[model samples]
Target: MAAETSFANASRRPRPLTLVAIVLLHLAAIYGLARAFAPDAVASVEDSVLSTITVTVETKQFEPPPPPEPEPEPDAGEQGNEGRKAVPREVVAPEPRIVVKPAPPAPKASSTGAADTSGARDQGTGTGAGGTGTGTGSGNGGSGQGGGVATKPEWIGGRINNARDYPIPPGGRQARVGTEVVVKVTVGTDGRASDCSVFRPSPDAEADAITCRLVVQRLRFRPATDAAGNPVAAPFYWRQRWF
Candidate 1:
């Protein structure tokens, strides 16, 4: 009875011999499956690596392009290719052109003598001549009136040359050629016409008219004053005509 119980327990406690053998068999099967299938799978993977075929068509070594052709030489007579300039006849120094910087108007040629009133100059009629210096100084075109300042004329008592003195052409409807007047009027001290008229006139009627209009519009003068500096009441003459 004791022997039978020990045998039963031994049987229940698995024996190592068969277990080890069974384990070794299972490992061998696994190793065989890995070996046989792994190589084939690796081959398939390697096939995927070489996706495209590179067929080399080796021919010959490459060569660069040929050099460009040289440019043609130029002819002697013609400049480069076209017409050439003629040689200068002689060397001439450039002239010294007097730019005249407008010369500040020559300081009005300081009158070493008294004012010349001979040519149609005023008679000093006590009407209202401005004064000895009746000329409007260099006009600045400013609209402001003078501040009791007196200005002298370039030629006192002298009548500015006018063109209206000539009789208009007496031909079919003789066009009334207005004067192109630049009257250098000399206003007397009496405010009356001492000496006044157009300065120059143009032979052309139209041109003369324009000048006359401009000069007339520009006429301005302080009435001639008496010795007391009072404005004289007289008609100052403004020569009117055209060159």
Candidate 2:
């Protein structure tokens, strides 16, 4: 009974070879199951394990580039000065000049035989009482009836009384052969007839009136000058006779 009990305990303890063989048989069965399911089941288990694992990546910060430098300013004596503004200059005007002229000298006076001291001239055709100048003078004791130099006015176109220009009275009013008309006309400084009047009337009044009208219309004179040679208004005498 003691030996049987010892044998029964040994049997219950399990043999080493049988345990090894059973472990090998279980491994073979697992290998066979893996082959049956193929590589699909193995890949799914690897993907599950890899998906559960977490990976961390670090990011680096980048800095910006530096700013560009500014350009230098040009000097005053540089060629760029041609574009600069120019300073203004002051201007001056010249002074005006003045001039003066001298007056003319007085005319010389004529002397006679007795050497009269008076400054007047003698213009009479006949003998005078007393005069300093020549032309039919006989007086030496007193001042003569002489005055300043005088000149008669002359017609601008020609001598008056030309029959064609100054015709006789119309309608033959004057039957007399010796019909005459005389007029006195005043000439202005501008050599124009300013006024006229009949000095001597003809037999016919129409003849006398026509003489003065024609004188003013057709006559213009070189105005008479005084002793000083300046133009002066003077009287002019004209006569017209009809045959």
Candidate 3:
């Protein structure tokens, strides 16, 4: 009986639990993993643009076929109809193809500059922007800093822009001339330079002539603007001078 008890205990002693423990340990095993990122990493945005596409066209020209020769009329006893008051046929002229060139650009027109509204030394009237400037007038001021100053190409003239900027000749100066005269001419909305007098004049007659020329022919103003800032055609004055 004691031997039987020992055998029973040995059978129930958990059978040294080796293969089951190994399978459980294998199932519990886990693998390790690692990851890294750059310091300047940023999210990106995507955009799409539609491009203009054009289709290419090809063309072929064809020439007209020659006119058929007139059938000879039946002979009437060997008599030709050359003298029988032959009917006059209408003649068609051939169409000729010629290439045309583009026309040259028209001359641009410029007006006297906008009246300086700022209270600076502008057109030199003591009354401010509306006031005239000191000094007599001439064709243009002395040449500026560079050997030649830049001038804009004139093309804005409609009927005509009289205010043209004339370059003063390089050899035309000896010394500065006399007291400047300032004239305040009220110009109408039209581009014409009217009521012209010496707004500013040099002491010399030549200088004053510059003012007259500007008033009569060269001085132009953009059409006067209305209260709403829209451009309207009207008469305006030439406040010209040279010094």
Candidate 4:
């Protein structure tokens, strides 16, 4: 019975060395599992911490200094007449001078002679009366004669009648045959008519122009005369009947 009790106690109470070996084996298994998963856990923690963390930089700025104030100007009233002074001057008078002039001399008188009356008494009786009457008659005859008078311009009738055949104006034949055109002709000092203008115009402009041309070509005149009988240029007018 004692031996059986001893065997039972030995089974119930394990050996210290075996218990130590089991704890060593369990510790070794836990160390191997921690070694295998530590790298992945450390990598995952580093990724989360790096991804969630942020860094901010602050910058500082300096402000500019204020501007300087301008200096004030000087007052005008305080320095108005600081260095000015008045000076005195003297007045001088000029001396007067006198001048003299001579007077003109008077004219001298002339002498007169006496008259004789012995011949004057003899002529006053009868002989002087007949001589005075003959002198009066001669003076009256000289006063009656006068100077020559000046005359006006005169038209040459024969020359004007000869110039009746004037040129027929353009379209003049179609117009009424009895159209009278009057023109003023300026006669030069040489007795030729120049610068003729139509005094009376026809219905046709060409006829009026041609009439002036014909008058200047065909007409002639005796120029006017001055009071001294000098021939001068004058204007005269005449009429022509269109055929």
Sorted on lDDT, best first, the list reads 2, 4, 1, 3
Regarding lDDT, does 2 or 3 come out ahead? 2
lDDT (tens digit, per residue) of candidate 4 on 80-161: 2122222222222233255254323211222231221111221123212322431213232344434332443445633222
Tens-digit lDDT string for candidate 3 (15-133): 44777897777655521111123222211111111112212211111122444987974432221112122222233223447637543322233223232121233232232223332
| lDDT for model 3 | 0.37
The candidate that achieves the highest lDDT relative to the unseen native structure:
2
* Candidate 4: residue 51 Cα off by (Å): 99
Q: What is the Cα-based lDDT of residue 158 in candidate 2?
A: 41
Residue 34 CA error for candidate 1 (Å)?
99
Cα lDDT tens digits for candidate 2, 18-108: 8999999999999779868787887788779755643221111112243387587443221111122222223222333752543332223
> Please, what is the TM-score per model?
0.19, 0.34, 0.23, 0.32
| Residue 175, model 1, lDDT | 41
Q: Which candidate, 1 or 3, has the higher TM-score?
A: 3
lDDT of 2 at 7: 88
Worst 10 residues of 1 by lDDT: 54-63
Clashes of each: 40, 0, 43, 0
Segments of candidate 3 deviating more than 4 angstroms: 1-183, 229-243
Report the error of model 1 at residue 215, Å.
Answer: 14
